[model samples]
Target chain A: MILLLACVLWCVAFRCHEWLQSRNRTTFPMPVRAVWLNQGVRALAPCLALALCLMHSPALGVLFWLGLGSVCGVCTSVLMAVLKNKRGRAPAGKPPL
Target chain B: MRDTLRVHMGWLHSWLGFLAGLLLLCIFASGTLAVFDTEITHWMQPEVPLHTRTALTPAALNAAAQAVEASERQGFSTFLSLPSHRDPVLRVLHYDGYEFTGPALSPETGTSFAPRETAGGQFFYNFHFSLRGGDHPGVQLVTFLGLCLLVTLGSGLVIHLKALWPDLVLLRPFGPRPRAWVDAHLIAGVLFLPFILFMAYTGTAIHARVLLPAQSFFSPSPAGPPKKSAPKGRLLQAGPPLPPLAPLITQGRERLHSPDGNLVLFTADDVRIFRSDASGPFLTRDHADFSRKDGHFLRSVTRSSPTVATMQLVRGLHYARYAPLTLRWLYFLSGLAATALAGSGLVVFLMKRRRSSGENAFFRLAEALTLTVITGFPIATLGLFWANRCLPVALTGRIMAEIDLFFTLWTLFAIHALLLCLRRHAAAAWRQHLYCLALAGGMLPLVDLLSGSHPWGDGAMLFVTVDALAFLSGLIALFAAQHLRRPAT
Candidate 1:
């Protein structure tokens, strides 16, 4: 459904954050690539959702985008929790971090 | 530099946002619920059998009119309304003070089902527009508040202009109270800006009739009581029989160019058939009139002027009666977000001044009011639903009793809130009130089940959807209450 797709888009945004945090940063702030990667996904989530909704109805698509935006916040919180847990656990053959 | 426009706008934003946000919170919350007003009414009155969602037939009009006539015999000035997409029940409604509550007549036959007298969904719809104040003041007052809300939003946006987009997605749930609430306010405000603006614009425009009575923005629709030549003497006696409905329906549809249109208005003289211009982007109330006595074609009412048509479009956008189910749900979600936006703004205001005004009596008073209005109103709303089922059916003034319960519960919560603030237990009061909201919302479905309504199995989707929604809201409230369980600083 649209809600799940929206959630996946949101989760994908958070996954970008996970990717950034998991990067091998020699210093505290991390490198430029990781920062862009996180910011890029965060920005793309909304535009992609808007684009998907706009294909259905041009006039009302904006409203749908708003609804999706609201849902994405809640979904991102939920999905981030799952992605965090997955990342927190060590790799399949490795021990816990 | 300290006295620049940004600082002035910030001052305006805080003052205006808090003041307007409180009232807007009530209006927004109730308005969101009012989207499914008919379904709520369906859940409230368990006696009436759910009819299939279909267009109201000509026979439904005859039945609705007959039911109105029966009420008229009792000295009640009544009107008939046929089913529409949002509310697919042909019912006869009579005004009680400023709200309408009456019997649901059968669509196939003219027989009226004597449902329990309750201040049904009309209570919320009426509350949104008039706040129970008649045409003179309530409508205009709500419109003024709406204008204030528009200004408040503008000021808030200007104050946050520099960082609006940069912090747009930021919401720090675990941060300090001010940071979290500021983030909430910002996210809700930025995301739902269009929804809030659209509703405020369209809602104020449609209700502007009260402030400026001369402007005929759309052809004024006659409602409530008969306005023209009907004699007042024999109104209770039912002087004449109604002409056949089928031929008039046919003529009205042919003239208006929509088969789904129905007779929304009827008197001894003229019957009006309302058709939504469905093919367009906006909804409309274009109708054709015919003589009720002989079924003669009277006039075709249309909003043709570009100005009036634009007004009609805004009006349609406000109610959104023409929207398909998906669009309606979309509107409903956006409306909920708007309500949340107003609510979060209130929390932000309270938390921002907490340190400076921690012991100030006026600050305490405002915080108490915020708690009472935001959480207490939902408790009162759920109380209204519960009262309808629990009150003795044979009790005198049962309908009034239900309405009284709503106001009485709200007042009691206000008193409770004020007492909590006086005792310096406002934080405790917030937590307790959230629990009350959780109980009120969570128990709604169970309450319906206990009342033998069968909300889940074998019940109509209207009843099922309402209960499921109430339960979902209850869970949300419970989650928030738990989120605030940590001891207050």
Candidate 2:
């Protein structure tokens, strides 16, 4: 769950407009403070997740976090691609489905 | 200069990746399956009652010891494995050249029951490391392949460094076939980089002794005592009775500072109690030895030296015996991702060359070999399971028969692929193989439901899980086959 949140925060901080647009949502250009806040949270969420995992058990916790984090990141990316293609909204330069 | 370097690196990545990727696919796939070897073994032996959480009784241990002694009398060097959460039966096992095989004793009754002989998942475990070719040649080859994988990964990174992060999450499954394959190769390779790197490095390091033998710094002096010769044959002799194992286990656990003792190895003179691999992430063979005749504690051996401990840690990470259920599943997924990365790289290589090399005999053979390695292996694996169900349980040489069937199926698939490629119908071969995989995988659950031993019994969940995964694989193969029906963009 924490990893999922981290992925979401990352997508938002990176301004994944294609994903957002496909979901009938929009995130207009943010103010400087908002942009920084989004980026900060995006970076911090993974660290927080790591901390929580480490609190469980130091060695195995690190391994678990890395493996789970990789899977979640890929799943998030695949989800974005699927959503964008579903709505027939390929990015400007990329080929359409 | 940068363009030239990138081009050179790309050449290295493509050729080496194609050459080594085939064997690496087998290694990764088998290693992934080996992660669940115990569960698969359990599933294979349906005669064994499920949920048999009977406590490890002293009688059971003694019974297992007796079994070990008997096997020794018959010229087999064996050890006793104590019951654990994963396998709740005392097992007396010996290396049968390919895997450990022996009788399993009931924890409650201290009596033996026959579980039909099959290679079980240990086949995968053995194939993962040795390719079932034994220590000298097979391990050496695998270690070499591991080095090749490392080099290929490095060159690949060099070729893609500029776009690494920018395209980290980019995948276009609906794009042109070659583009989709490249995207898949990149995404899987990048996302699972840590896992594949760790596995490759640790796996190679574990077998360093085979690849780079250590030299002795000091030679034996003429003054040194003569080396003792190995004992003469006493296959029929029983030297000593084993001391009661329960107390020794407790003492060994205390000595090792571990909560559980998992293995007891017996010799003519002494018994050694080993700490369970499940006890921690460091798979130390921390064992406490005791005199067999008197049950007196002799000495405790722990790999406390920095070098040995580091090696143990490396082995532990690769083996992952200490991983919990969830973490193990994570390992499984990561391993599959790594396999996909290799498979996609192979496909991309083929697709990129197809137009230019379509008429080349060697290129056609390469396509055939790729089909055999990627799809043929899974087909054989599924066929092995099916054979396990179909073969009569009481037949002699049943284990050999099952193994032979697995190889036969693989060989037949390779032949089929070769023939089709010779006829210049390699694409049809792909679709046909995928359809076969789909049929086999899709019907696996149904076959189990019909012929499985007590499918709805105590261990129903394990059966269900295996069936579901097979069914899911079948569905994916079906999807891939359907995708192949469309013309190439």
Q: A1-97 in candidate 2: lDDT tens per residue?
A: 6445444544453334222222223323356675566557656766776776676667677886678677876776777667767767534233221
Candidate 1 runs further than 4 Å off: A1-55, A77-97, B1-3, B51-61, B72-77, B209-240, B276-281, B394-396, B454-460
- Computed on C-alphas against the true complex, the DockQ of each candidate is 0.14, 0.37
TM-scores for every candidate against the unseen true structure = 0.84, 0.92
Give residue B404's error in model 2 in angstroms: 0.9
Span of ten consecutive residues with least summed lDDT in model 2 chain B: B229-238
Model 2 stretches astray by more than 4 angstroms: A1-37, A92-97, B216-238
lDDT of 1 by residue, B69-181 (tens): 67767766666566555555667777667567777776666566677877777788888877777665888888988888889888888888887654445454444556556
Q: Candidate 1: RMSD over Cα atoms? A: 6.3
Q: List the residue pairs that clash in candidate 2.
A: none
Candidate 2 residue-pair clash tally? 0
Model 2, residue B274: distance off in Å is 0.4
Over B217-261, each residue of candidate 2 has an lDDT whose tens digit, in order, gives: 465556878886433332335558777888998888788876643
lDDT of 1 at A95: 13
